[model samples]
Target: MRKLTAGLFHSIDGVVEAPNLFQFDSFDDDLGALLTGVLGRVDTVLMGRVGYEQWAGYWPNAQVDDDFASFINGVPKHVASDTLTAPLAWQNAQLIEGELLAFVKKLKQAEGGEISAMGGISLVRQLLFAGLLDELTLMTHPVIAGTGRHLFEPGDPTTRLTLVDSQQTAKGNVVSTYARRD
Candidate 1:
């Protein structure tokens, strides 16, 4: 089965949102290669309702390199939200309803490519609780968000995460890759 990797940029306080308020931890090209590597292997992206809204509002018109632009523009996005309607801003996007776990499990086992979730706190929590997350690729910034939406809430669940890879950049960014124990 393909892995479900959730790559997040967070503070020591576990805040994932509004990271732009903090100084970027990445130097000129320190972690660009790593991000590019992950994006290169992405076949599909799964996002929660909030993440979908944010991404739908931002990425479509961002002026960036053609490769990065194409990756976001062309990738298929599966958003788990019943409130959202069809005909979203991004191409090849859908709002999936019903048991999110079962749906994602089938998607992971399907005869296709890798699925990744970035900056989806609620979805991350759900997956974390279900132990559906295969790997967590985190880039921790030096700055901390004193207040914002935290990545971990009241779940208080125990999950296995084995560090398979890690690296730190001169820009005060530490990148780590963790695999699920199961």
Candidate 2:
């Protein structure tokens, strides 16, 4: 079965909304290497409506030549959205059919490389709560984002996660991997 994993740029205070605002200084060679390794294992990408729209608008027309742009544009993307229609504008992107959890479960059963859920707090929360997410790696920066949406909020159901791996970058970013405890 293909493993479903998620990697988010998180803050020390658990903010996962917009890492671009706070993660610039903490981005180092080690962090870049870690993200590259994650991309190496992922053959498919999953995104929520907001992330899909944001990335579709940028990555397709991005003038810069980079590994991320190439990989994201070339890899197959499954978008979960209730409002978006068929014939997605971005290359290799398609609207997901049927229920989100059901589709993901079926996809996991198929033969493929690792599946990555990228840049969607709501989507990641759904997958994590439904027990569909296999691994979650948070690249936690050393800053406190006093305001913004967070990955985990108050009153959420208790979910146990086991720390499987952890490393720190020279710039003080802590990259930690957690597996859902069953």
- Candidate with top TM-score is 2
Give the per-residue lDDT digits (tens) of candidate 2, residues 98-153: 99999999999999999999858899999999999999999899999888899998
Those runs of model 1 whose alpha carbons end farther than 4 Å from true positions after fitting are: 25-27, 64-66
lDDT of each: 0.80, 0.93
- Quote each prediction's TM-score: 0.91, 0.98
- What TM-score would candidate 1 get against the native? 0.91
**Which regions in candidate 2 have their CA more than 4 angstroms from the true location?**
none
Clashes of each: 0, 0
lDDT tens digits by residue: candidate 1, 1-182: 98888888878777778778764644337777788888888899898888888877888887766667778778888888878887776888877767899989988999777789864888987886788888887788887679888777775767777999998877768888988786
Q: Best-fitting candidate, measured by lDDT? A: 2
Against the hidden true structure, what lDDT does model 2 obtain?
Answer: 0.93
What residue pairs clash in candidate 2, if any at all?
Answer: none
